[model samples]
Target: MSQDSLDDAYANATYIPGAAEYPPRWTKEARAFRDNLRENDQIIEDFPYGEGAREVFDLMMPETPAMGLAVFVHGGYWLRFDKSVWSHLAAGLLARGWAVAMPSYDLCPSVRIRDITRQITLAVTEAAAHVAGPILLAGHSAGGHLVARMACENVLPTNIANRLKHVMPISPLSDLRPLMQTAMNDDFNMDEAAAMAESPIFKKPLSVPVTVWVGEDERPAFLDQAMWLAEAWECGHVVEQGKHHFDVIDGLTDPDSLLTQMLIGGDIA
Candidate 1:
């Protein structure tokens, strides 16, 4: 396919109606949610995991003692967004009696994708120090790709890896070689070797369980990406009907949602 076609395939907002509206809505809801949690003394704002300004993460404590830790990484193609914009997403896991950690990492052009992966590793390690029991990871889009990376052998330390209960990568870019052809690659600065090395599809999955989740209404590229990871890792895959890239993550807001269940359930063994 031509470069233009590749861009079209990976382009999400172009096909999703009113895509521009989602961010602002998310920002508003997330802000309100965080404020309420803050008022109730249920959150720890700007918990630092690294010295970088963007390396801080917010740890949201549940109403009762946390059963375990669930870390969520947000997606903006690894070029946009921060942990603050996604504060609301912690609701589902927190409601499920788990502490949720939302982390912000240095974006591309400022740091490479590999660097961002390491930043998330630091965030997870730091968050784990505060919470106990099992560790569950879930990320959306680019964030999905990051979490999936955690499942790769040697990506995470043995101590953390041993406690991993599950990993759910939603609409992940498992094979990033195609992305190198996209216009966004300019910021990624990834050559063939870098893309291959970072791609979860090309890496071996650790013994921990994984689940590749995608939206049936997502662009074909994302659907293909999800399938590639599931097939490569030989893990569970779910394509939610009527859901698109933007709304596919909405399930994370509901404690009873299937996405939430699978993420914290750790039943995919």
Candidate 2:
């Protein structure tokens, strides 16, 4: 592929038809889901981790005694989507007796990716403070990359860090340097140095196990990133056949999914 083609390859919109529709639908569905949760007083809304407007998160408490927290970070290539669009995705985790915390963060153009990474560290840390048990960290897309970084680097303080039981980065862009050649870089403004610093593939092996799951039908770049990171970190990779970038995240919302089972400490095979 030419440089331009390689750059286009990184943009999911280029490969997934009707990609623009997902966000709006996600917004609508997630809003309704949150509203329903709030109506029954099943959720804790607007719990702030930072002063910024987007630094807040919604905590969906499990109906029974809680299992643990599944801290999920929303992804928009570090540009779009807030935590609002992802509230319902926590249903699977919630059903499995896990309290789910979905956090929002400042997006790009207003903040750098590094800043977003830090915000998630703060978000996860804040969520940990409230739920003082094992933390199952999971994120999708760019959010996936952030959680992976948290695994490699010591994002949380020692006390909280030890509570992080597992990390799941679904279809993560673990190698961020490639984005420098893509149009998304316009908003990201990720120079070579920053990309290298942020890419978890370049970081040290994580002490916590990271189970990476990807869609078989996703672009090769996405596939390569997951496989590369799993190999580099000596972790597990679960490739679901016939899934694309968009539907690949469906696992997060399904209790019986291999991906969700991985996060909740169940069987994947």
Tens digit of per-residue lDDT, candidate 1, span 42-67: 99999999999998999999999999
Model 2 over residues 192-258: C-alpha lDDT tens digits?
A: 9999989998888557778998899999898999998899898989899989888888877788887
Off by over 4 Å in 2: none
lDDT of 1 at 18: 100
Query: Scored by CA lDDT, what does every candidate get?
Result: 0.93, 0.86
**Positional deviation of residue 185's Cα in model 2 after best superposition, in angstroms:** 2.0
Clash count per candidate: 0, 0
Question: Which sections of candidate 1 miss by over 4 Å?
Answer: 266-269
> Candidate 2, 16: how far from true, in Å?
2.3
Q: Give me the candidate number with maximum TM-score.
A: 1
What TM-score would every model get versus the actual structure?
0.98, 0.95
